[model samples]
Target: MRQHLWMICASLALVTASSAMADNFGMAGCGLGSMVLQSNGKEQIFVGTTNGTSASQTFGITSGTSNCKDDAATVAAMYISVNQEALKRDIARGNGESISGLASILNCSDSDALGTSLQRNFGGIFQNTISDSKEVAVQIRQSVYSDTTLASSCKAI
Candidate 1:
């Protein structure tokens, strides 16, 4: 029981620490995050362009050294944010890939027919939007731990 609590806490901590950040809709200031970054194996580069309100104040913010746009960062952000939604859909539909992938991440493997059971009972654990994904994750961990079939679905890590 104590071990189960620890694992749930750890999973929540990890998810909270790694939630995606929303994108900047307007001209954004250049920071080190904007200056040096890369994702999806592509080069990352961005510029602090002159906005209508502050063109004179923002002189030569862009280096213009690289031709690549900042799309790599944008796509990276999108992928992370949208992945949670995709996982929810996949779990509801019992997509094997999504289930197995999530199991691997959470270090829970099926010893018996845990996957089948989870598919049958998915609605019990996932019935609403995950406003706090980390909290939801913790709840899921606790649920999985308490349920015999769900616990069997994962390998003890």
Candidate 2:
């Protein structure tokens, strides 16, 4: 009976250690410049743009889908498409001379401000669609902004 109790204690210790290791690794992997958050209350996952960087952009799901972990990649792809479209629009509208301006526009002064702008912009674009697929698209937009910033930052560094 004592041996069994010892074994159980050992198992619990292993589980605790494993979880700590996972958390540490996850944080380390994200690195210094990146931000990370899991969706908790709502189906929305917001990725806000970074400050003091021309790569500020916000990505989020306003309504429709919930629990976006399974489709992260797909959502990321869609964001790329949306950003491309936004770029084209910006160019046509004479907003800026180059794609870099799009980057600047996305890189608003603050993350929360960027998020508010994105919610307004994307809300209009995705108003008609249903939630599940639309949410994935929203995720894609967020991914585009985040990926673009990361890529640009890497190039700068």
The candidate maximizing lDDT is 1
What lDDT does the true structure give each of the candidates? 0.46, 0.37
Query: Per-prediction count of colliding residue pairs?
Result: 5, 6
Judge candidate 1 against the unseen true structure and give its global Cα lDDT, from 0 to 1: 0.46
TM-score of predicted structure 2: 0.27
Q: Per-residue lDDT for 1-157 in model 1, tens only?
A: 9999998678646533442232222234333323222121222222233232334223323552222234432333333245656656666676656556566544565622435545555665566665445543554455567777666645542
Mark the 10 consecutive residues where model 1 has the least summed lDDT: 37-46
- After superposition of all CA atoms, the RMSD between model 1 and the true structure is 17.9
List the RMSD of every prediction in angstroms: 17.9, 15.4
Over the stretch 1-157, how does candidate 2's per-residue lDDT look in tens digits?
9999998678656644444322221221221112232222231122122211323221212221121122334433444356655533543343433234333444433333333334445544344434354453454255345544433432211
Residue pairs with clashing backbones, model 1: 108-154, 108-155, 109-153, 109-154, 109-155
Off by over 4 Å in 2: 21-109, 112-124, 129-147, 150-157
Best by TM-score: 1
